[model samples]
Target: MEISTKVQIVTKTTTYHPPLAISSFPSVPLITPFARPANCGGIYARDPGDILVIDEQPESSSCYPPGFATDESSFFSPGLACPSGYWSACMESTGVNTITTVTCCPIYRSDVSLSCVDPATLAGVWKSQFCTFIPARSVPVPVTRSSNGRTSTTTSTLVNPGGINAFGIRMVYQSSDVVTASSSSSSSSPSSSTAANLGPDSAGGSGLSTGGTIAIAVVIPVAVIAAIIGFFLLRKSRRARAAQPAALPAQIEENPHKPSPYYDYKPIFAAHQYHGGELPTNQASAELPASSESPVELPAEAQRHEMR
Candidate 1:
């Protein structure tokens, strides 16, 4: 089912208003809004002519980001002013010894149009009214116990012999031209020698480097093994070289069963070569001296053969 309703349109006379004036601000008052004291979506603001106004306020969490914290750095330097859209805010941190005040941006409405004022500059502004500052508080010094297990409430002031200069570096001075320890009667040469010999360069070194030690340990054995192998090889070569000369004069042994090679050669006479006419026919024996090829002459051999 459809129900018909009447629609009405009304027109007003031409009214003069400043350029860029809001439809309901600095000129006309908006009708009763759903929320009380609401002129805009956020907190109370100021009008040009001392009239109460309202404008958009950023979320409280926006001030916690790192970007806003950097802009709020204006809190550190009193002379520095906040950037065009940023406003300085003070944050308090309670420490064990003291409370620290950190400056930060209160409203993080960077993308949107909003008003930001310095709390120091504006004494009675709405921005200052909403923001509160922490007062300076005094802190007591901590009590420390001595090594002897004794505790005391009293404190002692420490004096700095080497005072810091404008650059925050401690000033150093040469106490005396000569060392005081040298004047002592006792000899300190042994201790100085020990300190100097502690490391390759100086006693300040913790110890020899592990890599160098390991390299030395590995190289020494390898060098020893290589030396030992070289020594044995050289010894074997010398023995082999010595044996070559002795082997050069070696002679081949002659066969013992064969007749001596030093014997004189004589051809045996044939039966036709024997002269039977001069002697008895068919003479069977002709004796010769024994051992004709012997190196030494026989003392009294000349054995006679039997006649056939």
Candidate 2:
């Protein structure tokens, strides 16, 4: 990779101290060139080990190494943690401040811009968007350098971006990354087999994937709805059955202890002789002895009676 070291008039309000003037003197060693992250308000003179935050993208006009970026440049926050390294200034910066990295793009005027705010208000900086704070992930990569025939590998950190929520503003890409990747691969390899491998495979695979995803999305919801409906229907049927009145078997009347109305009364009458009140109608013609007369007889004839 080629690096540009020309000290152009990158900014109107920037200054630089002699690089080696104070290095030899232990009492006054030259300050190392470093930058603060753009979103971290602004940078100030501090110890190299001092922790700081990089909040925004560096300006394009400022000299910057390739592949380094801050929160403002990335559509998402790079997972890089704060207080690790210097962040770049936005392109709107009037001059290059040695304390921060420079942006690689033009100053975003109407669409977006960077400004200085208190550290406590840093979270509020992105209030225009839903994001309250940036979550960054940093990984170290090997950077090999040869100094006067001595080659050494040093670590250069890279940040991986994180996820966003559904409420975030939609990001639209003017062009697809697949096109650039395919073109770059084809140009570098210069092989017929490689070109064929990269051809319509992606399109076909993406289509199939989309179809499968759609099927799953549609089927899962339908199945869940059906199951819910079935459960409710079963519950309703059970409840209706439970609430219904139960039936009982027919009944027959029985009076085993009661006397019958058709019973004969002769058996009670024959047990004891009844006089006047119980006399039979035929007995009324007969005469009975009186107190005055001892015996009263009735004869068949007067003569017959005297002979006897």
Candidate 3:
């Protein structure tokens, strides 16, 4: 049986990576060696494409696939060429001038295994196997090109400082042809959709918002209920006060009858009555009674009647 494999090479500009401590390791020409105490074989400090023979096997060189470049390190500035599915990490010690290369391979089954080329040398700084490098996110921008391969314009904007976080990114793909990219206001760094979905920059402070909404929801009903109760109580008090009776006037109680009795009226009525001596024959000679105003004297019986 014969084995076949396809190799691809890619390189990306270095963004940020820690520098390699050359003082800790022995120095060699063209190889920045690091002293790793755990490994049996010494690690070689070489560029991304430098070859190294591993455990009785032939040496392998650094490689990358499509959508990637092979020359730049991650420490370089923005707009530098990089490959999809891979991100550049610059060494803090190297100060953006050095590059560390990584290679990856996929297997469908667990029985098949792939290993890193510099396992003994990269014991601390790198692992012994080529594993999948998953990033948190990716922000891609589009550039318009003419028929002659000249860039006419930039149709989409790119946001920077956008990428996967600790959560890791699964994949990045365009949902539509008319999709537009958003660039960061401060710089050319690409911003991620997560920033937009999480309310303008990935700030997860929703507790304040929820608290405000809940407070409003709770207080409005209580205020309405209090207002209704107060209205009903006020109306009931007014109705109770209006239902009471009115009091009687003083003039009606003081005088019970239409007219009052007088002193001289009784005497006049007695004088008009007939007496026994007055029955004599000459009725035409009878005289009319004088006015009380002239001080006429009253009989004893008339006086008793007036007193009563």
User: Who is ahead in TM-score, 1 or 2?
Assistant: 2
Model 1 clash tally? 0
Prediction 3 global C-alpha lDDT: 0.28
Summarize candidate 3's per-residue lDDT along 153-172 as a digit string, tens digits: 34332233321111011111
lDDT of 2 by residue, 122-239 (tens): 3433332222111255544333444566756455453434211111111111111223323343333211101011111221111222123445799999999999999999999998
> In candidate 2, what residue range of length 10 has the lowest lDDT sum?
165-174
Compare the candidates by TM-score and give the number of the best one: 2
TM value for model 1 = 0.18
RMSD of 2: 23.8
* TM-scores for every predicted model: 0.18, 0.21, 0.19
Off-target runs (Cα >4 Å) in candidate 1 are 1-207, 252-308
TM-score preference between candidates 2 and 3, better one: 2
The lDDT of each candidate is: 0.29, 0.29, 0.28
